[model samples]
Target: MNRTPESLTAALDAAMATLDEAVAGGKARLTPEEIGHITYIGKGIALIDGLPGVRSEELLMLGDGVQGLVFNIDPEQVGVILLGDYGALGAGDLVRRSGEVLAVPVGEDLLGRVVDPLGRPRDSRGEPVCHERLPVERPAAEVMDRAPVTVPLATGIKVIDALIPIGRGQRELILGDRQTGKSAIAIDTIVNQRGKDVVCIYCAIGQRSSSIARVIEQLQRHGALDYTLVVVAEGDDPPGLQYIAPYAATSMGEFFMEQGRDVLVVYDDLTQHARAYRELSLLLRRPPGREAFPGDIFYLHSRLLERSTHLRPERGGGSLTALPIIETEAQNLSAYIPTNLISITDGQIYLSPQLFQKGLLPPVEVGKSVSRVGGKTQLPAYRAVASDLKLSYAQFEELEIFSRFGTRLDDETRRTLERGRKVRGILKQPQLSPLSPAEQVMVLYAVTQGLFDAVPEPELSQAEAAVVAALGILPDIVRTIEQGETLKPEALEALLAAARKAVSPLLGPEKVADDH
Candidate 1:
């Protein structure tokens, strides 16, 4: 066992040969990972030094599995928006680059499920079965890849569908003061998509849990949850989550849109989303502009909304329609954020607090609400019946205002005011009750033709309900209307006949005598 110089040399040479063989075989390769340390931590954000190779919006892992996004990358350090509970993280904690941008799970499994911005299930439904993951921030479809929005997206609300129509692939703004039925309109639209083969995604950013629960309950009650996806970012969630919520939800919708399916995404209100981004930007020391918002606030929403468009046939011919809700301060439409959104979207559906106060449900202000592109997408039947409806209603509004001064002296003006009241009554709809296209056409035809003018104002609702209920006997006429055909003379006669019969019993003797 005594070692000699020659024997030691022989053993050392053999060990060197083995090491070279392992290296040449690629079995001993070295893997270098970049790790950094948090230099400072702020509310929902952290400044990290080192890891100079991190990319903007890249996902990073902090201490104890907390995730962060690289927001501001400078020579000295990078600002990260924390995505999880950062309470466990402190300055000097370890940070590792995930080397990937933030992505969310997207697939059929998301239907009927409630998830967070990170695609984590919050509905206690266990892990979602997602077969694919898409980056939260994706470039929109090219201009050539988009198609004109010719198909109508019916909200089943008589007023919206007949007057302020929404088309597939349109970006429609729903804005109003608080407690003015803005959310009600959006939910009704979602519920209306129950049998329409449209996939709906309701992204609630910075909303109360109870409010979100009520929405879910309504969707479930109407069986809309079957094809709907609820993506929630509660008010208590980190600002980062709220900021990325709509993008993640849009990514989820894009999956279906690319599959030749129509998708509807509702950003319950972008006010909070903008606020969340503002908070993050200020904390990260980004330059602020008007209203203390970052300069890119316009781009922030534009890019998100631009993702919704109708695709060309070669690109699967699908579409993503957006209903972005915004709350106004004291009904101010010219405010900074409201004006920006008004300029971005295709049209605005301005709800009126005055109308709401008057017990007009949905409370959509006809004068302020408009659909820029939806006019081209309305049904032929609507054009035949409601073409002059909007103009007449606007005139009625003007005349009614003047009449309030007790200055009305003309017979025609009095009749116009009376008709306007009846028109408003017909447009008033209950929550969760969406009308069929044929039914909407039926009721619209009745009012536009002055059939409801004979019924007393209080009896208008019953008369309209009776007209809708009596539609079953006019199956052929309903079919014709729903086929998007113009209402022929015979069809109009049939509609009027059925409507008159249904409304006659409800009319009082005084109303009947006045009509005669």
Candidate 2:
């Protein structure tokens, strides 16, 4: 029954008197809807004594506009929370529906604003124009189709770009220390997608208000917020909101992907998100495990991150690229949370704070990261560069380190060191710094060719140009090769032959050899 002001007022007076009596006399009984109604006032919810349909004594939350989240809703007797204390809640709040759902805005006006889980603008910009609304409540996962990831998502991080590349529908985890640039990398990737036909959803759960604000400002400055959706659940929000923030963002991303638009969904950090679930679990009397987290922590991450996938071609042919960030304490990645995430993702871009301080923006440790699904999305030119880049770096690194102590190094090792240095220099961009696709391909070629070796003194522009000029010639060479495969050695050789003649004067007479 819909409530008018007078009727709701009468009902409230009666309920308030009853609740006061219960608080004073120590006894009260009510039905689930009544309990749902009462929980908006503040006692944490749970399955109470012998309640027929009580799901759990979880907290109930209702924002000003939408339907509230009530866990155990019983239609009988209106189960009531007598002394409920909804912090900052007014007595005038009415229960809408007993559903834990929210709406998604579909209009273009939201292009530049940062929003929270409730879809409220956090950017201080203005209200977002709504086009469509969606229910936050999800049905069971049985009917959903499972699909593999095959589309490329250019994060523009070197180690990740070369070794641990992510496909359109891939779930790529970024695990690292507090100051290791995890969130920055995710944000940069989102910003980089501005001109591309991609939508970005950034979910910030249990993050500091200041940090969240900074992210919003960063997105706004870069104009990435225009094409991105920001879903924030701050550190002070109820645990329930933290648990649902990512889901709300993912739903928004899925909506676009279904319409044949690509979506990049970044879970700013899931470590706190998982902890929030564990907090609620413990509060509800669930048993804890090795890390004092609920046993289902792994499953929660798996299910959430797995939601990013290239839907089967028959299903609109769009994709959701997932980049889930995990914060590891003291850089101990062996912790239960990091391990659980590592197992669930296709690959991880492990950022080291030590490297970040050493001036590496992405700080991605190539040796520590590996993409298991490499064959799925790597283009021929990219794959060719990646395949040999690692070996060269390793060979160069060993020689360079020893040579620092005055040891003589082999020519091959010296060349590798120069290449490695150029690679490192190129990767050292600022946090949340995004590079263009053309820029990525250009530098990629610089590494492939030993351009670093011939530079008596490497100028940034020179290195950048050498790379762009190399990549400018790839389309003509790989025109006949199939997508998702590396360019053939013979094809590459022909390109390199012309490249040598073209660059001999500009880069000088350095021997460029073909890998046989």
Candidate 3:
């Protein structure tokens, strides 16, 4: 029952069939000269996303490496989407490997600035004036026959030290909900690593501009700007760009890592990065999963983060530590993405907004957060103090919960409760101040040893923070304690004496500010 069209329709129909076959399956080998110069326009190489579309019937080179191909139709003229290595091409790019895939470069310039997936400067600073760029997803550092994580990675915070301490080449995930200081924890870690011979990369994906800016400012304030590299893929970036952001940052981190140097990369939050992929998938007509995210979402994140690792002993003894943050909606740790991260990391620092509001800056839930890798790399001093740290914390939690029942206990029970209360106070600090590792150990030991029992139950919080502040512990303290060294009992006692002496005056009745 099909009606025949006029003479012109016959020729058009014949051409369309040829176009379809060539676009979908025909072999089209571009000459070496046609690589990097291809036009980024969709007409040249149509990308319809998930759905297959019209085929390219013919190809011609514009001589400057620019490839002009005839497609049955253009797919909305969207800009080119890089699928893979850009380094193989140069300014006079050719199309020999037509889809070699444009990628961002990794190098020394990445420290302390925000960048996009394409490795272009997303901070509006123009293309990074860099010495070089590298492809984003490279291989993992050598596996077995590898050196252990001997050095520590300090975050300048007390709780992280006394518990959940990080080590070089560790893959630690920072999991939390919004406004719980996830990024803050990451930045603090980077800033504190300033002089530790570690190169830092901060990759920001789908974050607000203001928030990204604040990250840079924090680095600058801590004098970590020069040594830190920033890679940003903000919320305004195109879907394609956002999808590639973390890989670009990884590439930058790998540069330092390969040279036998320590490298730390923080993918500020992978949730948005995954969202960007889902958007791209929908646009390309790919199937959606439960969250409308691509089915390979887990693989995508794993591959990016897996690139960070400790190398084999024969591989220059290099390492890449990753701190990939995940923001769970409504603290839904059971969600696919959250669970995926919780499993991938060696450990997690579970930040809670509820605790932060109650004056826990890092707000780490010591019970929920743990390093599965054990204290393999903690400084000896840190190890010693941390052994009893958790026990003390558990006691504090149990006693506090029991006190809530209002069943008055014996005098000894009340004293134990008061001591536990003081320990919690010592760990609390203002919004940004991070402690020295020494201070962390001292506070941990003091609280666990029942040294703070006399500080008064109500003033525990402020009194706890003062012990370190007055002694000027931190920055230098954690390092000395963790340097694979030892200390005599006398020396240890001397240090504690100094911290106690510093806290005594501030623990008086008129020292409300010290306790607060």
Compare the candidates by TM-score and give the number of the best one. Answer: 1
Candidate 1 C-alpha RMSD relative to the actual structure: 3.6
Using TM-score as the measure, name the better of candidate 1 and candidate 2: 1
Q: What tens-digit string does per-residue lDDT give for candidate 1 at 235-306?
A: 999999999999999999999999999999999889999999999999999999999999999999999999
Residue 214 error, candidate 1, Å: 0.7
Please give, for residues 398-453, the per-residue lDDT of candidate 3 as tens digits. 88888899897999888777776666676665655666667677777667665576
- How do all models score by TM-score? 0.95, 0.76, 0.78
**Cα displacement (Å) at residue 311, model 1:** 0.5
lDDT of each: 0.93, 0.67, 0.68
Candidate 2 global TM-score? 0.76
- Per-residue CA lDDT of model 2 for 9-56, tens digit only, reads 999999999999879987566644632233233333323222244343
